[model samples]
Target chain A: MEHILTAFGDILFHPTVLLFLVFGVVVGLIVGALPGLNDTITLAVLIPITFAMDPKYAFMLLVGVYTSACYGGSIPAILLKIPGTASSVVTTLDGYPMTQRGESGKAIGISTTSSVFGGLSSSLVLMFLAPILASYALKFGPPEYFALAILGLSTVAGMSGDNVLKSLIVCVIGLIISTVGMSPQTGYPRYTFGNDYLLEGLPFVPMLIGLFGVTSVFEVAEGLKSRVKDGTFAKMTVPRIGKVLPDLAMVKRLLPTWITSSAIGNLIGVIPGAGMIMAIYMAYDQAIRANKDKKFGTGVPEGIAAPEAANNAVVASSMVPLMSLGVPGNSTSALFLGALMIQGLRPGPSLFQDAPEVAYIIIVGFFVANLIMGPVGILIAKFLSGIIFRIPRETLTAAIALLCVTGAFAVGNSIFNVWIMLIFGILGYVFNKLKLPHSPLILAVILGSMMERGLYQSMVLSKGSLMIFLTRPISLVMLAASVFFAGAPLFSMARNRLKKRAKRGAIS
Target chain B: MKTWKVDIILAAALIVISVVSFSDSRNYPDIASHFPVRLSIVLGILALVLLVKSLIKRREEAMFTLTGEQFRVIVVVVAAVALYTTLLGHLGYLSSSFLLMIGMMTILGFRKKTVMVVTALCTVAVVYAAFNLILGVPLPQDFFMAK
Candidate 1:
């Protein structure tokens, strides 16, 4: 506790950290408010630049971006009826209607206030919970780690929404991609095909930039001709924003909702692959049940508050798995995991004891970022309305493409990485066109090497005994959880089908 | 075309790839082949499941189709990116990037010549300064500099 407080003060007084934090917030707001850009792409593009900075400062920037982007997404959802980020899709249900009633400012205010409440609450939770979890995870062995990775994989595959088979296939592909370089257990290369560059496997940063950045550019290009021909760009006009602060009574009415939604969001965030979309929807459902007197999709304050609070809560708490167990909870946190590895910081139980200064700075940095995001995000929402839409889509698309190319090349000074980025970008674009989920692929790539290494090490420890995993208590529990997660959706689907058949029989 | 048809095609392709991968993994040493062989088998099985599901449970939902104009725009963007990457090696980062930017904007229907030229130039300048001067990261050398 004392060390955490000291680290908190260290970041607070440090000019460079404070400057980068504020810069990250402002950048996150602009990017988040842009429809195609999100925190993941921004983090992917910026991670290369951070290779030149201190790890602590680099993470402060990332934490600030992660904290604010979730709130920034609500801006367009309120005014333009287009969600800047997918998580804010729920905000549009009531936000656009509020705009129709000339209450855009109040809607923005409620969103900002609720988002800050959720962010701060989750930051407190993260601050307290992550360290304890990390300390506990220090007891885990290779078998346990392997089972934890399997659990992560199964949870993501299970919760992937109506396409578990497709998700599992992509995950397998990603794992295969991860195996391209030299084997961890043996020095022999698996699939390098004689290229020296392939011996290093695919470069992580370039692959990410391609997936998040270049793919976005391709998507924007796909929409380009239609948006131009239909005059959608010309038809867009900035909506008027009224007063940007909620009154005391309005805050009081929203207090219980803020607490409930934030708690829900944080819990969902901690679960691997559950994601912000689920968090927001679950919270919105809860808000509807609680506020029966107020109609939900009719511009109610509770409507915007529920999703805004919930998503921001998810932003802070999603880092829990990454910080504690070295498993990423979602794609964005997976990027953070990549960033940590780039900084030569292995994220796990030992991270706290090994590098308390860096670890605590990130945990405490989330608290300060939320404090800064409230006012700064509100101010940006008020003033940047007209400016945001004025930038032409063509220019934005071009700029993103160039950034993707340049950022990919900056990592290793190799043109090969640029090609990798292009390949993944095209792959990602095709995945989107096919409606395949990208989360499973991304998580699988990040976790694959860890899983394989743990598996091999466990085998070595147990002298090729297949029962070693089941014999260990921790590994057994984790494997059982993985089995449950992997099977739960299928079980539910079967049950629902049976119930439907029973109902049909009753009707007959 | 129906989405189920597309899924069938995708699943078939994935099954072939996984089979080939599994066959390739067989040539490797036991220690190196262990994980990949199992992973490929899993992938093959999953692909088989998807194929069966799509075949048996066809749906009427339309596949994601692009309009003519949208397809043209995407093709141009892709071609332009391919051209830009090739040019990056020959013409260097600054010159090739300027061309790429101008080409992308024009292809995307930006008609303001002065603004387009200025934006391209400004983008090159900023990228050079940020990546080279400020961050000390190297960009591809200019053709003249290489000589």
Candidate 2:
């Protein structure tokens, strides 16, 4: 604990790290305020730039972006009735109504307050729980780790979006891609297609930029003519935002709601692939059930508070799994994992001990970021909303296009990554158009290597015994849990279908 | 035109890819082939299920036909990006980027010439400065500089 605190002093006192954190907070707000951009794209674009800096400050900048993006999303949600980020969708339920009632300033206040509270509390949760979780995970054997990877893979059911089978297919495709590099055990090339570059496998950063950033540009391109013709472009009208912080009385009044939502959000964030959108929905649902304000979505502060708090809580706790088990909890956490690897820090149990300073800095930086997001968010609320919305989509789209190409090439200074990125970007765009979820695919790419490592090691240990997974208690329990997660959704779907048929028969 | 038809096509493609992958993995050494072989099998099964599911359900999702303008905009953007990639090492970062941004912005319906130029120039400059000076990362050299 003392060492962690001392590391905090070391990082916080650094001139460059402090400046980058502040820069990240401001940039995060603007990025999250604009409808065209969000956390994923911003992080994807910025990862290349971070490669030039000290790893600690690099991480601090990215963490700063992660912490504040969730809060900045609420600005547009309250004002324009358009969610700047997907998680802010729930915030729109009450936020826009609050604006209609001339309480836009109040709505922003509650959102900012709840976001800070959730962020700070969850960062603390990360600081304390990461050590405990890492120690527990350290005891996991090869079989247990394999089963845990399966458990992570099982999240495809929750994240698959309307079509579970399609998601599974895409995820398997990612696993296939992950197989392109040399085998970890034998060092034999598998799917390199005779290319020397394939020996090291697909580059992670380029793949991410393709999937998140460049694909977004393509999708935005498809809508360009429509946006132009319809004149339905984003407006620059800044909404009324006065106080930086919510009233003390209001905070006290909604304290229980905030606590409940934050706890629920943090729990959701801890689970691999239970994303922020789900947390918002779950927290919003709970708040609806428990709220005394009867007005509900008609613009109660609790409605905005619940989802904002929950979503911000997700930002930090999502890092928990990535920090502890090295298994990213969701797509954003997967990016954070990539960032850590880029910084020469492996994100598993050894990371906590091997680089205590780096780990502590990230955790501590997350806390300070939230402290900065509130005051900075309030100060710039008017300025950002007014300017960001007015930035033409054409300009933004073109910039993204150029940045994607440059960012992909920045790493390894290889133009080959540019070509690979183009392919993935097209794949992403097509996948989006087809309504197939790629989160599972991205998760599979990251976890596929880990899964194969564990499976192979366990096989070597057991001498080809398939029972290794079932024989060990920890592995057996994890396998059972994976089975439960995989089956429960399908079982419930079947049960619901049967109930619907029975109800129709009764009516007939 | 139905989305289920698209699903069938995609599922079949997946199966074909899995077949190729499975065949390829079979050529790898035993120790290296373990994961890919099993994964290929899983892929085949998943693709087959997707095909069968689409056939059974046969849901007709509305086909969104793009306008000529929209199609042109997309084509222009894609072509611009491909051209940018090809020319990066030749024309250099700033020179090629300026052309790509201006061309893309025009195609995307940014009609204000002065505003477009300023925005495009500023973007290229800032991105160059950030990536080059601050980060000390190298961009593609100009053809003049290269020679």
Candidate 3:
């Protein structure tokens, strides 16, 4: 505790850290405000910038971006019907409706307040929980770690959302993509296509930029041709700071939702493959189900609070895996891990003892980032909302394309990477056009490599017995949950059909 | 013409990819082939499912079709990237990057000569200053390295 306080004081006093935090917030806001720009892409692009800074400051920048981007996404979602990021998709339900009702100010105000609350609460939890979890995680061996990885894979079934078959297909594809690089256990190349550049495998950052950024540009360009011409800009009026406080009734209503969602978020976050978006959506679903009388998606504060809290909570808890086990739970966290590696710091159980001050600084930085997001979000909301909407669509598309191309090339200074980006961009576009969910594909891509690595390692350890997964307690539990997740939807559909048939028979 | 056609195409692509991947996996030892073989099997199964489903449900849903203008815009952007790749080794990172940005901006209908030149110069200067000078990361040198 004393060390933590000292670390907090150090971070507070460090001029470099403060500057990085401010820079991160600004960059995060820009990325989050722009449609199709996401936290992962922002982190990936800013990675090259971090090579010059101290690792502590570099991580501070990433933490700030992660927190602020969540808040920044709400700006566009409130002002425009379009969600700036996937997590903000639900925010659009009431956010845009509030805008259309000429209360964009109130909506943005509430969103800012709720986002800060969620972020701060989660950050506090992260600061306290990470070290404890790391200590416990130290006890894990190869078998335990393998079981945990399988547990994480099981979440893919739940995340697939009404499409088990498609999700499984996506998971398989992701595994394939992950195997493209050299086999880690053995030094043999797997799918290098006879090119020396391919020996290093597909770069994560370029592929991510292509999937999220470049594909987004094409989608936006398609939308631009027949653009919705609603020129009504709401008069910007921020609610007084005092007015942003939660009332007794509001607090009482939101407390359960916040607690429940945050817990769910943290649990899902610790498991790789189930990202914040999934955590948020699952929490939202649970909240709605539990509070059946309350009409969600109708500007209810609880509705907003649940997902906001859950997503932000996941942001911190997602670090649990990365810090404890050296496995990144999501793309943004993966980038953070990359930054840590670049700084000559390896993340695993020993990090807590070996570098307690750095860990403390990161935890403290998360808190500071959450605190900064509220005021910055409110200050920039009105100015940015209008400016972003008015930016010529053609120019935005062109800039995005340019950024994507440059970013792809810069990943490894390989032109081949640029080609990969284009290939993925086209795949993304086609998937979008076909109304197929790209999240599963993206998630599959991210997890695919890890899954292959884990499965191979486990098989080697178990001497080729596929029953190893079932024999392990943790893996068995996770597999059981996956079965439940997969079966529950089918059961629900069947039940609904039977009810409809019964009603029709009664009428006859 | 139908949803089945799209499904067939995707399925065929998946099949080809799986087959190629399986044959390729044979080169690696058994330890390495384990994961790829499993993945190929999964891919083959998914392709079969998709093909069957597409055949079963032949009706097409209304889809968003891109206009010629939009297609042209995308084509120009793609071409700009291709041009950048072709020229980067020869012209170097800074010069090639500048040309790519200017070419893309122009292709996207930014006709102001001053704006184009300014945007090009500023982008190159900033990117160069940030990546090269501040970060100490080396950029592609092209003929400049020889000099």
Best by lDDT: 1
User: Which residues of candidate 2, in runs, are more than 4 Å off?
Assistant: A1-119, A122-134, A227-366, A377-385, B144-147
lDDT of 3 by residue, A413-463 (tens): 667777887777777677766545554564455556556666777777789
Model 3, residue pairs in steric clash: none
**Docking quality (DockQ) of candidate 2:** 0.51
Model 2, C-alpha of A62: deviation from truth (Å): 11
lDDT of each: 0.81, 0.78, 0.69
Q: C-alpha displacement of B95 in model 2, angstroms?
A: 0.9
In model 3, the fraction of reference contacts reproduced equals 0.41
Each prediction's TM-score versus the true structure: 0.71, 0.72, 0.73
Candidate 1 residue lDDT tens string, B1-147: 698999999999998999899999989999999999999999998999998999999976987988878878877888898889888989999999999999999888889999999999987887677667745668999887776
All DockQ scores: 0.55, 0.51, 0.33
Tens-digit lDDT string for candidate 2 (A1-508): 8867886786677878888888889878876764434677778778888887888778888988888887887887786554556667668768878876767778888898899888887898898886564455445677876776787677566434346778788888888888888888889998898999879999865776676666767767787678777776544244455664677799897788789889978876776655676567556656755763366668988889998999999988888878888888777778888888888889977887899788888888888899989989987775644554457778877876776777677666787888877877878777867777666676677678778988989988999899989989878987897787677667766887899999999999
Chain B alone, TM-score of each model? 0.94, 0.89, 0.88
